[model samples]
Target: MSSGNPTVFRTLNERVALTLLLEHGGLTRAELEQHTGLSKASAAEVLRRLENSGLARKAGLKPGNAGPAAQMWQLDGSAALVAGVDLTTTSIEVSVADLTGRVLGVHTTDATGDVRRLLGETLDAAGFGLDELDQVVVGVPGVVEADGRRVRQAVQLSGWSGLDDLPENVRLENDVNLVAIRELQEHEDSSFVLFWVGGGVGAGVVLDGGLWRGVTGRGGEVGSVIVPDPVTNGRRYGQDGGPLGALLGAEPLAALAEAHGL
Candidate 1:
C-alpha cells in the first residue's frame, strides 16, 4: 500500500537518481535501479523526470552482457556553473568552471570596488554572465569566522566593507586556505601543511585528508606568532611592523631586494 503522496516520493527518487549520476558520471537504467534499489518502473519514472527537468541528459548507450544496448544518462554539466573569486588589495580575478571542474574562462582586473560590481564585470570579461553562476567561492586575505559568515584580519582589504552585501551563494574563505584546498584537490588523501608568503604570511593546515581550520578558521595564522624583531632586539608593537608579519611578509622581502639593488 502507498504510504506517502506519490508526487513527493517521485521527487525524492529523482534527487537520488541525479546524485548517483553525479557520482558515477553516467549510468544506465538498470544500473540506476541496481544502485537505488528501485524497481524498473520507478527508475524509469525518476529518469523521465530528470530528463524533463533538464537535470540529466542521454549520453549514448551502455552495452549489457545479454541484452541490447541500454541508454546511458548523465548529469548535465552545464546545468550549473561555479565561479571562484580571488580578491586582493590590487587585483580581482574571477574564474568560471562547469560542474565537472572544467575551467570555462578566467578574467583578472586591477579594478577594486564593490565586490558584486567587480564580479559582474569580471564575469563579462570571462565570457559569462553573473546570472550564470550557481555558486561563487571568494578567497580574501583574511580568516573566515562563524563558518564563513564573517572575515577578520584582512588589512589589505581595509577599503573593502566585507562580503555581507554579496549573495548567500558567495562564500568567504582565507586566501592561503583556498590554496591549501587546491593542494588537497591535486594531492588527495594526504596530510600536509602549506606556508604562503605574499603581502602577508599565512599557512594552511591539511590533516588526515581534510583541512583543519580551527574553531574560528585561524589555525594557520603563523604571521602573528611574535617572533623577535631583529632590528629592535625587543618587542615590536606599532606601525604594523612588530608582528611576525612585518619580519617575513612581502614588504620586508621587497625592502631587502631593493636594499641589495636586486
Candidate 2:
C-alpha cells in the first residue's frame, strides 16, 4: 500500500536506507535495495538524499561476487552528538556519544548549584560545548510523566524539577526506568523486577519483553506503596516513609542495624 505522497514515500525510503546502514555499519546500493525492498532507482535516490543531508557517506569499496567493486555507504558518525546525564543527589554524570553510538567522552561533577549550568560544565569537560549536542537524555530519581516532560516526585533531588528551561530536545526519564532498560539490554530474561535500595527505594518492572510503565507512568513506583507504620504497627505509613523505604532504604536500614547492635 502506498501513501500516494511522493515526499512521504521519499522520506520513508531514506529512513529505510539509513536504518540499514546504521545496523550493518556499511552497505552497497545493491545491499540496501535487497534489504529494504526498494527499487534500484528509489534506493539510489534515497542514498543521494542521505549523502546530501550529511547523514550518510561513502566508506570504501566492497568487491562484488561477479562484478567490479561496489561503493560501501555508512552513517556519518560525526554528523550529530548526544549526551546522557545521570542526575543523583551527590553528583552528575555525563556521557557524550556520536551519531553511531560511540562514546566520545564521560565526565562527573558535584551536583550543586543550577542543574543547567552543571550540565554545561560537564559537557565542557567531555570536550564538547552544550550547543554541539543534538540531544540530551536526563535520568532523574523520580516518577516522570508519560510525556517525559515533568518529574512528579523526586525525594532525593528535591531542588530539581522538569527540564523546562533546557533545550527542546532534552528528555527527562525516570532513573528507575532507565535501570530497567539497561537490565533488559544486558540480560536474557524477558521479565523481571529490579529493586533499587538507596537513599530512596524504587522498583522497575519488565513484563512481556517490555518495560511496563502503567497508564499513568507509575507502574514501578514501589517506594510509594503504603503499609503499616513500623513504629505504630497500626496506621499506614505516609508516602515519604513507606514500607519499602523503611525496610530497604539506606538510612532506615542503618538505623535498624544500629538498634540491633550489629
**Pairs clashing within candidate 1:** 236-242
| Residue pairs in candidate 2 whose N, alpha carbon or C atoms collide under 3 angstroms | none
**Shift in Å, residue 176, candidate 1:** 2.0
Which portions of model 2 miss their true places by more than 4 Å?
A: 1-3, 159-163, 181-201, 204-212, 226-242, 250-262
**For this target, which candidate reaches the highest TM-score against the unseen true structure?**
2
List the lowest-lDDT window of 10 residues for candidate 1: 232-241
lDDT per residue, candidate 2, 21-129, as tens digits?
8779999999998998888998888889899999999999999889799999999998999999999988889999988889999999976657788888888988989
lDDT of each: 0.83, 0.82
Question: How many collisions per candidate?
Answer: 1, 0
Task: Give the CA lDDT, 0 to 100, for residue 140 in model 2.
Answer: 87
Off by over 4 Å in 1: 1-53, 63-67, 186-190, 228-244, 250-262
TM-score of 2: 0.78
